[model samples]
Target: MVNNSRTNPSSDTISYLELLQEILNKKNNLLGFAGVGLVLGLLIVFTTPKEYQSSSFILLEPEGNVNSFGQMGTLAGLAGINISQLPTSQMALTSDIFPDVIHSRDFLIEISKEEFEFESKSGQIQTLGDYYFKQRPGNIVKKTINYIISIPGIVSGWFAKSDPLPSILAKSDEDQSDYLKLTSQELIAIGELKKRILLEQKGKLVHLNVEMPEPLIAAKVNTMVLERLIDYVTAYKVGRQQRNVEFIEQRVKETEQKFNEAQMRLASFRDSNQGLISQSARTREEQLQFEFN
Candidate 1:
């Protein structure tokens, strides 16, 4: 009789219905938070101001003779000259020069003036009476009145006390100047106005590609960059050519001088030897015969 009945342990566990209810309660709390968030988001969106934006794109290309050095070497070899010591590339496109030219201070100044026109104005007041006596009884009174009323700060401050003309003008000038400087710097730093500019070297081809945000600007900038690059390269090559021409002219002049001296020496030797044959005469004879042949 002392309780021989066995208890079923699994029956003591919480039922699925209770667990489902607890989970549903958490879900409801989460839904409430989401609803509040939605309302706040809608309020913010309706209150915010809208903004519009415009953008441009550009592309860049390589300028000038890409194979000039190689071509020059071949030409030199054909001319029977040793040009191995000559530089393969010119200095026109040096890394520092391009950016400096593009972002030059003078250029930015010009652009600023073109973009922003500034004007200054002054205000004046006129009054008539005995001109002086009606205003003040004596010189001392007149002087005090003039000091207090005619002086810039005293009269203008009292008259147009809240005028912001001076500050506005100053701010406008500063902003315009700063804008020009920043734009120029950005152009220089970004070089070619491209989305990206790429350079790579292969066995035969040296590849360059540039991309920009605006198609027309991209094309124009790309073309201009290429043109400038070419101009720099061409100028560099032409400079080298001019230097070579100078060297050749100098050499030719020296050779002519030597030839004249040799001729004079030969004449003097012939006269001293009474027209006798000499080694130099024989050499000259051989040179003439070679030229004729």
Candidate 2:
């Protein structure tokens, strides 16, 4: 048998290069591909929605100390109480906790329920919640990519088994709670809110930013959310002070009762004794008289 094992490495390399060159020689095909790419790029640029951000900076100060309540402070001291520490040493709210408050289910639910006149990308004015839940526009590219990526997960979930009994019991228990439990619509609103709103704290300052496709709506939402947060913090401070006021009032009532009883007893003693007096009793009586005077 004749051996024919020798192959030219240079010839194989040249052939591959010739094939690539032939493909490049087809200018019509190359131009068509380029044109398609250009059109897609332009479509993406034009079709993608525009976002407007409206932001505000806030300087958060600690709630004033209870000691600042001039006359109330004095009265508290006289009553042998520290009015300065009546409620708390400082405001309950801080920049660190502000984000948590804003993200809380109750707060988000309140925000979702609020009605704002928002003009959508399509120039139709509607309630903010409605816009978020029912009419929000989608990005074609993003939706397509997400759907493609989630194909595997969707298949797996379809095959997975679920236990109806425990799920039903847990859902019923959740429904019975007074705390804010998000419905499907409310949950969608929350997801949109999270994407649109940003919060950050620096030193003693808090910066809030809200974004939307509509400039007017963006600004309105930003202002409204900030106002809500302020109101929540103020209400907490007022509530603490109210409890302090109630405490002081109760103590005052007790002190008055004791004073009234002592006065009545002294008056009765003087009535029964008439003109009777001894040095020690006389001195005591004079002291009582001085106090009454």
- Best of the candidates, lDDT: 2
TM-score to native of every candidate shown: 0.35, 0.66
Stretches of candidate 1 exceeding 4 Å from the true structure:
1-195, 275-293
Q: Can you write out model 1's per-residue Cα lDDT over 1-293, one digit (the tens) per residue?
A: 58788866666555666777797979988899999988766765664333222222223334344244465445555444455444435444544344444345443233222211111112222121111122222244344665776588755667775545698797777778545344533344333222244434443344444443234433444455445555755687678766865554565566566667767666665566566487877776556444333
For 142-237, candidate 2 gives per-residue lDDT tens digits of 657767997999999999998666877889886887765568777778878878888998777799999886898889889988999989888887
- What is model 2's C-alpha RMSD? 8.8
